[model samples]
Target: MFMTLTADSGADRAETWVERRRPALHPRRSWASPEPFVRRPTEHNSGEDVLGAMPWTRSASGYQRITVAIDVVVALAVVVAAAALGGAGWLTAGLLGLLATGTHVSFVAALRGYERHNLGDGPAEFQVVLRSAVVVAAVLMAVAFLTPVQVPREAVLVGLPALVTLACAGRYVHRRVLHASRARGQAMMRTIVVGSTVSVRDLVRDLGTAPHHGYLVIGTCLADVVDDEAAQVPLPTLGALSDIPQVVHDHAVQVVVVAGDALGGPALRRLSWALRRAGAELVVAPGLVEVAQERVTVHPTAGLSLLRLEIEPPRRRLMAKAVLDRVLGLVALVLLSPVIAAGALAVRLTSPGPAFYTQTRVGVDGREFRIWKLRSMYVDADRRRAELLDRSDRDGLMFKMAADPRITPVGRVLRRLSFDELPQFWNVVRGDMSLVGPRPPLREEVSAYHDAVHQRLNVKPGITGLWQVSGRSDLPWDESIRLDLRYVDNWSVTMDLMILWKTFRAVVGGAGAY
Candidate 1:
């Protein structure tokens, strides 16, 4: 008979799993029983049968290989182009090209660019690629200056930038493809979450919202005392902390996430050893929510590794960001004037309303500002809002409807293509908003905000933010709030640029615009 493990004690509460192949010779043992419950060799318990239960997803190593190949190809292409432009001989160009490619790839590998864990996730991968390029360029310059070997100026001036740019573009395209596959549930790692029921439940919910991250939680292991919250979790309780290895083996789990104080240092170390033998990855949740990797630094002291999280970004960086926002905002407004004018004219001609719509939105520090947008709704849209409030497709203070009746025919196209938001560049230029920041909220939404939600007001609101590129109106209220808070706490210039780049793709795709 198969054994069913439970947190409760006593033989009477013990349960058996699967079919009863033979008679029970004695009462089943509890989880605390000293005698180990060993399973007999049966057709059902074979290694092949267990492994076949959940086959591994497309290996991350495969993508890593593809990334390496792309980088090498891009580096070589850049070298060839630079050599051709510089009129270098074949012998010298071929030698220098091979050397440049080797140096670039070597530096990237040294910086953990090809690490399976970092590939296709977060901004770390792109950061690593850029760092490698900078390092390679510096090294080439140093070698040329310090030694007799002459380095081509074009290689340093042209090749480095092109290589980094092309490499980053290639990696970004690959990441999009990976995300697309993951969205379809095609590429995902089978995972088991271990923690208290509450933590496990929260983790599962959060991970479920971002499936592109590629973790598929198949089951959970309750490490703390079983409580009422256990029933609320959707994943099956595979076993306790002690039975983690068995659960992993049975389910073919590729990743194990340990949340909360589920395991002590020694226990966690042992668990790591067990995972090593089992060929699985162990991830420990630091319990820091919405913290960016940049602000965190690991310090080893007194034989203990402590994570130091910076409270705020430096004032210098904040000043720089403000300048960047204003400059970019002004440039955007200047460059996109024709498009904005065309959109506004369309709105005015197609609907019986003003070309531009302005509304009061809460900005940094509870300040109110008039935000601009090309009119994307009928003249009486605001008046009709109350009647259609009950038909809202979204929950929370913010209101949205996939099939909103208030929008004009031309308005739908404008909203879908994000032409309606172009006029917000003026708000950015006016210093009332940011080029990239938290989502701008209406007065009604701001009034209903709780203490935690109010953290979003610490920075200026934006036309496109983490919320927009993430899912826009499709995102749930809590998820949107979490993203906004994350951005406010962990704001950086690099992060702003990344979000700005993603905004174009999000707007073009228009997946969640409505």
Candidate 2:
């Protein structure tokens, strides 16, 4: 129960003694349960001797090499393809093409596109791609006007856009591959969690919560308290903070994460030095959780790293979102008119109800609006809802049966493909909804909502959002709320587009369709 840390093998002997006493504390090398301190590799990174050596930096190195190869290939292909299409001489075409390609690569590099991405930080890379494209376009246009080089007009207009698309597509392919690799238990950092017992447990739970995040909690080195109760809490304590260097070397740790009041700057500096020798990077997980990276800007003032938080004005964002919703909504309505019509007819004939179902749902600011959908159930389906409440198998505030008898045969198919929701394009056009926002809450659902849930009302209800792309009816209520609230706080045009892109996949897969 008690151990003293000496300069040498003393710490190793103690850990061995502890592990022998509590074999359960020593998790098997394979992936284990979702609890903290499981010795199992997937208990957050599998295999200590083998997989612990599989650091993220190595995978990142390989990923970067592939990225470079993709960039070069895309750049060359775009230039050659554009030159063949554009009416320009070889010398002029080559010069302009190379210039555009070089400039974009440089811009992207400066924007940190090549940097390692955090897990769950969805699609932030695409924004960097767009910005780099804009800069390349502006520079090329300026050069054409200022000089007598005679740049090709068609090439500048069309080729530049094509180049951007190709580069982004290549990045997307690489990103997907990288994610897959991480999911398969490759590409993760061998992490040593250093903090108070509570902080280490919390961090383990948080880090372990998202397995694909690639932070493999191989071991722990606790802070402050010296009772060494870390093992009792069950994280494999590699002794005290003083034994960090030994632990890092022993486990081949690639990352050493400091949580809570673990070490002061001087102690951290010393720790960093020791970790550097072991080739491990140090990370500090501040207590502030779930802050969007976009909102936080780092400012160094008098040697202090200050986090400047930018507060977005609710009124301005909502106004801009309203405009986008109507414009896109009108376009969708026109495009999907035939599908909507067919869905309505199918519902009417099969369900013996009005073709269109319009129910009052709470929108932004608790305003009630008639949300439209093609009927997906019999005429008395809503009335029979009370009878099914006793037999509900649902998550949180949601009530959905995997196989509901109220659903008509046609309704089942409509719901499966989400064809019945097409009428909501009109709601989007009328400003009753948004292309991307929170779910339109039912009147009873809103009444049951707590104070924090009202933040969803700050923005208009969305048609396809984080909730839609995520498992719809199948997702737990808490997780659904978290995703919706995350969107509400961090909504952007790019985020909306990302959600829309993901929505297509979710719909096609029918992942959570009832």
Candidate 3:
């Protein structure tokens, strides 16, 4: 006969059943118990999960709060230092403090939003800094022009930009350092995943690939089964679902990722509640794959956790793009006019083509725009492209030839120094491109792109971008695409400036250039 063991106090009280089962079974007894075993019923409802009963651990939350507080304090200190160096009076110092505070608040808000809504994949450090800098710059400019404070116009113009730049650069360095520390196994959260073997294994694999998330999954709890096959799960199976509380207590788990579908409603509820009572943060990993966090929302309906996934609309920041491109582009063109003239003269004397080479390239949407570049190849370079196809050295939708014979003698020198790209400043001025964005693909290259690759066209192409300064032509096709997608997902003004700065160094170093 089969025996059905029922816990009366609800599933959460089921752990006591383990103790109860031990007593009823005599030592060396092999026969099954004929009578059904039932425990005394309690007030715990079926809807209550382990997460609900468990309180989030104070350690992780406390550290995050402390880190944020320190960031704010350091930012304020930097502002005070700036004021001291600038020799500003009380009003000026006050204004600088206000700007610094606003920047810190905005950055913290963006980071929190990214963590809560972005599903760990959001804008890069450069983009966040860019947005904050833009806001700070606008506020300082307004105060300089409108306020009666005796702040020097030059000081306002110079000091504000410098502070904004420094703040962003410093933040980027901090994030990089933090990530490096995490990679070295410092400042990490110990986590345990509770679910089926398959789902938990996959989640562990994904997490292992991204150490920057700072979650170290040290153990897995098999909630449903307890067979040898279940032991095949990648992580060490601490115990069954009933053993979660004990395992959590023993391992000092900071976070619990409960895969709900694998555990069933009742078991999951108990596990969640147990985790909460044990002071561990519960992170539910819904089976949704490849969905951006920005597209998901948590709506609590009655008592059930409702997850609503919304598709993001295509970006509609055209006015911002136009204003940024034209303003920065005009300034760049004016500043680099002498260099452009010299490049043009070199091209004219060295090659049988105009100083500037304008070609129709794919742009935002499916539109085509005439992109300008200083002549970096022979006049008949296009005619020679077909012959060089067999020598294509790169991958993906694009084609690259490492040693194309069509390049003019002087063109190689210009390309090395990125001098041939000087004329593209006019493209920026014409609003066909930005100072920073994805490199525009040739029309033929766009035609070869897969469906997902089309997302790169969501924003205007740039003169200098992640690809240019990162490794230029040296990066593999996959890496190039990854960097491009990263840029598109997290576009910001700060990133543009950072890329521009890097581009200058890259050009001077002549690394990874043709």
Candidate 4:
């Protein structure tokens, strides 16, 4: 028995996975259960199977290695460019460039910048490069001040930013390649989960949902759960705790993620020993969900381990973000005045309504603000909304329609390319919205929100957001909410900038645009 992992059936497998959505990875079948299978050295060659490079795709490890190479090359290029700009002698610059490169490589290694967990991770890569470059800059400044050898002011001023930018760009490209490869079922570790069925279910759902994390769950080692033998999970059950090593070797598993404590410390230790012998990596899940590694610090003391988590990002960063939003919004409104004017004109001429549409939307902390958009529908579109509710094909509290009868001819084009939302730049200027944040919900939607969902109200709503760029009207309601919640949890200036950059691509593509 074999089945595919689908997002819609994001629950306990049993019989549901077979009947629900049918898409993911390649169409190839994987074992649905373990049989009287034997392990032979010639039967399983990981290097020949998983690590073999197809003409179009490389292995995940190979991708990581290539990314490492790209980073060093970027560092060298940045150094050379900086030296050329600083008018330094070739020999002198070459020596300094090599030194800088060495420093960069050393810092990245210490930071685990090229680790599998960090590979294709844009924000992590960017943060590491920036912090490392800052340290490098400071070291140079201190050396110049103390010693007779003075570093070039031009290099310090230009090189740091250049190195950070180039390094981040390389990481972005690496992530892009990895994501594309993963979608095609390449560049992912053949992974297995070890835990109770319920605990493993959550982990599997999470990994399936975010396949870019690069773990492809092939089978699971489900520990004994009382009375759960009457239940069956969608995942292939390899065996109990005793059969782990054989299961790992037989399946050519590269990674084993231990979720919860179905296997206690001593048992887990023994399992780790088995995995080590099998040449597989082990990840013990802390059971903390959605926490960024940046917020975590692990320390070992007195034969014990402690994990510390910071509650939130610094207040100074949030303050700076507010300042940036207002400044950028003001500048954007001014720059996009002509485009706004043209869109308004189109709306006014094509529809029998005012060029602007305003609606009361809930913002940060349950506060309400009137959101503005270039009216893309008839004036009475709101009046006809109730009748169209039954036709909605989306999940959650959101409503959408691709063939919505209310939209005017001109409004259709504007909505698709997202030009209609340009007036919200003014909302961003008014501080009622932001350049990047959660999507503003209607009063009714906010009223229906669960307590946990209210976290979306922690920051001001946005003109564009994770929800908008994700799929706009076409996204399923739950995924939209997930993306928004994710934004609320992981908002950072760099993350915001990355979203904004992808926003351009999304708008142009009009993937889920209504």
Candidate 5:
């Protein structure tokens, strides 16, 4: 049977005996004995464990509270502003303020629910707008019925849309600023690894590549069975598994990740108990390299954690893609009809080919589709592609030339402003593409892709996506694939709207267009 140490008076003696029996259990070269420290009884004795088990971190909880507070404040401010615009009356304003606050709280709750379900991040812009509009509409109808405020229904309608737009826009801006700040090393979580040196080293190396994830590896603890010299990972070897409780306390670690296949059931249970007492989250990294998060699930049975890994299918339903394409494409074509005509005329007058170009690109499940675009290159551009292959300016599976000779003067302006993509909005409406999705590949490009690369075809191709907004033609192929896969694993309507909004700004600025 395994020995257990309770968190009472006996802890100090037990810890001292363990330390004497195994000096190597303590951190490397630390002469101080582990006997001086005493483990505190858990707060669970006071019935606080229920609240403590809430999944959110302290920082995340604070953010949620601040967000709620801000929404309430904004709702109150809006009520005052509306009243000042001639909708004044204390009773009316108070009612409106209550309604607005209730709406804000409801939307915030919806957003939180979405996040909790891992459906995506935050509520979609359209959903929020729709909800806000319903509330405003009801308020206006009530006011119209209740009092002779002399407010124009049309004016209220127009002003309400703008207000909703501003609120959503402000949220988008705030989130972006927060994400940028976090990316640049603010508000990061301090993490420590508990495992064999090799596993910890590899995990650290993988996480180091994505600074946006906001993980800071402070140190690593080698398993008790492993020797001290095996700490080949770049992080300092803080101690062994037995010393985890002390290391966590000393470093104030927010997350303790156990890596490797070396940990047995008893050690894992002990580490989990220690982590619980220390008020730190415990994450275990199953040694599956390069497997996406969506593919892994944990099942606990009889005190043993069983990980289930399954391969995801590649084909998404064509019907949904088709419907999205047709509806959005038709709407886009209508809205941009004048620009499309002007662009077509410009291309026709300057270039010898048709104003619109068609190319057979690889579509879902290795099928082919004729993609539409405003012609941005000369008729013989394909013939010229080979001559410029050796002078390729971009790297990865795709080819990009910064200053291709095949682009006509009119094409250059269109490409720079992303006017060439206007026609693809029609494709989006036509069921041929999505407004935001994986970038469709050419037949030749698909032919060269390895098995893993085929995962890109899991979703319908999009006119603009992470690749388009990030750096467009400037990004390398491997990084593009990574972003594409990330989107596939975590696609959300909020993400799609965010990408579309960023695409507009990117196109206007003409950054990385070539």
Candidate 6:
């Protein structure tokens, strides 16, 4: 059969193509077919108004404007304060402040820190801000030695750190606000996924899991090989891959995610050109799921760009982590001793058992450690576990019951506040655990693990890690293990610090504690 490609909208009228095809076992859906495709309702197609409705919408350049304003204010306030406090002449201090602020902002801009696309998500934003700060510091040091002007020591010592801290804090606060907006479905980018049926479905599922990332999947376009499985995807079938351009235009899509090899080199390039004219961003997924940006670098060779994966040696950072864990763990243990004591006292008074609970948990290298916690359940809690197995709220190896009968009234409060885990700091100090690592698994849990899951045993389990910060008991068994394994394979000291910061927030919110 001969098929003449056509455009539905006047804007796409000038660009049209044709294809000759033979009927296959599974006939492809036509855009002009009287049957309605799986497109979203008219309300979902109102995403074109999402950014214009709000002054600070993430998809607009307003986010970048806010970021740059924050950076300028922070840099100026810190430098000017330092210069004035150091007793510099008014003119000198003013000039110095301007120079420093300009240099700092320029460095950040040079690093693409203020780009709207990089503003709301990922560590790249913070990483670039940090890099800019480091470069500014080195430049200031050069100015101090190589020039006649004497840069104030206080500015170097105080201003740089203050600038970075305040800038990063601003970014964090802005991100939180953006996330809140996205959760309410306010600032999301209208997204269309294009690939094979299974690939499109998988991408949709993963994207749905983290709505805060802001790509709202409105529908999907199947590749040339349409199959029965296409019906299983939750997203509506916009059309076949060849119809992506028209689909993007009709839906007013902001982002087009190309998954798998639905479009080969020339076709993908052509799609990019089409998307550019439609003012939509084209994101090609290389199918490397959950890989950290730090591990991947792009190398352009012979007119093609290849991704080079670099694995940092674990041993290089292990010693630093060990030292940090012991120092911070001991300090935290000392500072929080009174709170732990109060929790233990509460547990003891309310339950007919010791205040502390100890259990043997498999740790790094499959070695066992006596994990400690403030007992939040009755003495017979362990004995009653088998009886409650059928009623467990969670699935897979991990067992969690939202309303377990074994939990004491006091235990519920402790668990809610996460004070029950305070005794684990002592374990951290004792070198049995790190400040951040995989969740320590039960011996029974370890025994049931598959080979891939065993990778979690490579590092010492933590008092608080990705699993703890990311929904805790609310996460399913498979999800929890996936997070732990991701941490084991791609953790840095920076990631540990980020996890610790998030732990504080999670504990305070107490959303998924049960």
* Highest-TM-score candidate: 2
In the predicted model 5, the residue pairs found to clash are 322-431, 325-428, 325-429, 325-430, 326-429, 326-430, 326-431, 329-429
Residue lDDT tens for model 1, 276-393: 6555789988688888888988776665567889997899999999999999999999999999999989998998979999988899999998999999999899899999988898
After TM-score superposition, what is the CA distance of residue 281 in candidate 6 from its true location, in Å? 2.2
lDDT of 3 by residue, 1-514 (tens): 0112233345534543432232111121111223221222223222223333322223334444544554466555555556656677766776676666666567656656233222222345435545655665566567767986544444445554665566555555655665776788765667888776778878888888788777888888764555574667767776655556555655666787876465444444444556555556667777876565555677766555567765443345546657778987898789989989998898898778688898999877767899888888988989888977878887765667778788888888888788888788888887788788888889888988888788889888888888878889888988888788877775555456668878888988998888
Candidate 4 displacement at residue 99 in angstroms: 2.8
Rank the models by TM-score, top first: 2, 6, 1, 4, 5, 3
How high is each candidate's TM-score? 0.82, 0.84, 0.66, 0.82, 0.73, 0.83
Residue-level lDDT of model 6, residues 415-473, one tens digit each, is: 99989988999999999999899878899988999999999998899988998898888
Clashing residue pairs for model 6: none
Clashing pairs in 4: none
Tens-place lDDT per residue, model 5, 302-421, is 544667775643245335445555776688889898998999999999879899999988766776888988898999998888888888887776888889888899999999989988
Model 1, position 268, has a per-residue lDDT of 61
Candidate 3: deviation at residue 317, Å? 3.6
- Candidate 5 residue runs with Cα over 4 Å from true position: 1-65, 79-88, 99-103, 106-168, 224-232, 260-269, 286-323, 489-492
The residue ranges of model 3 lying beyond 4 angstroms of the native Cα positions read 1-165, 193-202, 219-247, 258-269, 277-279, 287-316, 403-405, 408-410, 435-437, 464-513
Q: Identify the leading candidate in terms of lDDT.
A: 1
**Between candidates 1 and 2, which one is better according to lDDT?**
1
Model 1, residue 251: what's the lDDT?
Answer: 63
Candidate 4 lDDT, 1-514, residue by residue in tens: 0112223232334333332122222121222322323434534444234323322224656766887787678777777668767887777567667777788888887999877677675577778888889877876677679877546776678887888888887778767887887888777778888777788888887889777777889878766633364155667776654456666766777888888766544345445656666657788886887676666787765544567777787998788888989998999899999999999988888778799999999999998999999999989999999999989878779888889999999999998888998999999989899999888899999889998899899988987788877777778877788888888887778778878988888888887888
Better of 1 and 6 by lDDT: 1
- The TM-score obtained by model 6 is 0.83
The runs of at least 3 residues in candidate 2 whose Cα sits more than 4 Å from the true structure, single-residue gaps closed, are: 1-55, 117-121, 224-228, 231-234, 301-303, 311-320
